[model samples]
Target: MDVRISKRRTTGQMSVFELDALREAFRRSVRENNVTEVQWAEHAERFVKSMIRKESRGIQA
Candidate 1:
């Protein structure tokens, strides 16, 4: 699957409240998938690495 993320930059830091909300949403992702936190983190790591590799290949081409 090809997952594309836009390279848009946003200025300013998220407020504490917004940060907490994001945290809650992240936690919910794991809970909804019934995966342990460690497992979810590992999945994210692999996905990020794969994306990097794909980008590198494109650059080389």
Candidate 2:
């Protein structure tokens, strides 16, 4: 599947509470799925490339 992320910039940092929540979610995902950082990064790279290819073909995301 193709994934597209917005290029707009946000001004503020995440609150500590929000950061903790995200960290916990990530930990749970990793623990449950046995995912490594490298695998996650590679998957993200492939997803972006797919999105770019689809975009070049004039396909709406």
Candidate 3:
């Protein structure tokens, strides 16, 4: 299966509250389920489709 992975980096001083919120969400997700070992090839396919759909909707709006 064809696959694509996109990565990005942002450089800035993030607020403490924003950082804490992100950390909390990650902790919650990990506590809820073990997502570390799943096969992600299919997930990537769905992710790309979802992003495209969202972008098209934003454009239409």
Candidate 4:
């Protein structure tokens, strides 16, 4: 967590129509699940712990 990493996704010169389609796809996924705020935090914590365990074992998450 101490290390900082910054990355950007740059798709070279796409049309507005193409951009709209991509944006819509992302929005759809974000709304696909209906998790409450508390549930989300719980899931997130569990995911982080799982990731740490996986890394300790040198396995892909």
Clashes of each: 0, 0, 0, 0
Candidate 1 lDDT by residue in tens digits, 1-61: 2222222112334567856775675666657768776698785565457655875697566
Tens digit per residue, CA lDDT, model 2, 1-61: 3222222113334567856775676566666767778787765465457645865586352
- Best candidate according to lDDT: 1
In candidate 2, how many Å is residue 1 off? 32
Ranking by lDDT: 1, 2, 3, 4
Q: What CA root-mean-square deviation does each model show from the true structure?
A: 8.8, 9.0, 11.3, 10.9
TM-scores, all candidates, are 0.46, 0.41, 0.40, 0.36
Q: List the lowest-lDDT window of 10 residues for candidate 2.
A: 1-10
Candidate 3 vs. true structure, TM-score: 0.40
The lDDT of each candidate is: 0.59, 0.57, 0.52, 0.51
After superposition, candidate 3 runs with Cα above 4 Å error: 1-38
Candidate 3: pairs in clash: none
Error of 4 at 37 (Å): 3.6
Residue 50, model 3: lDDT of 68
Cα misplacement distance, residue 21 of candidate 2 (Å): 0.3
Candidate 1 steric clashes: 0
lDDT of 4: 0.51
If ranked by TM-score, best first, what sequence of candidates would result? 1, 2, 3, 4
**Residue-level error in angstroms, candidate 4, position 56:** 0.4
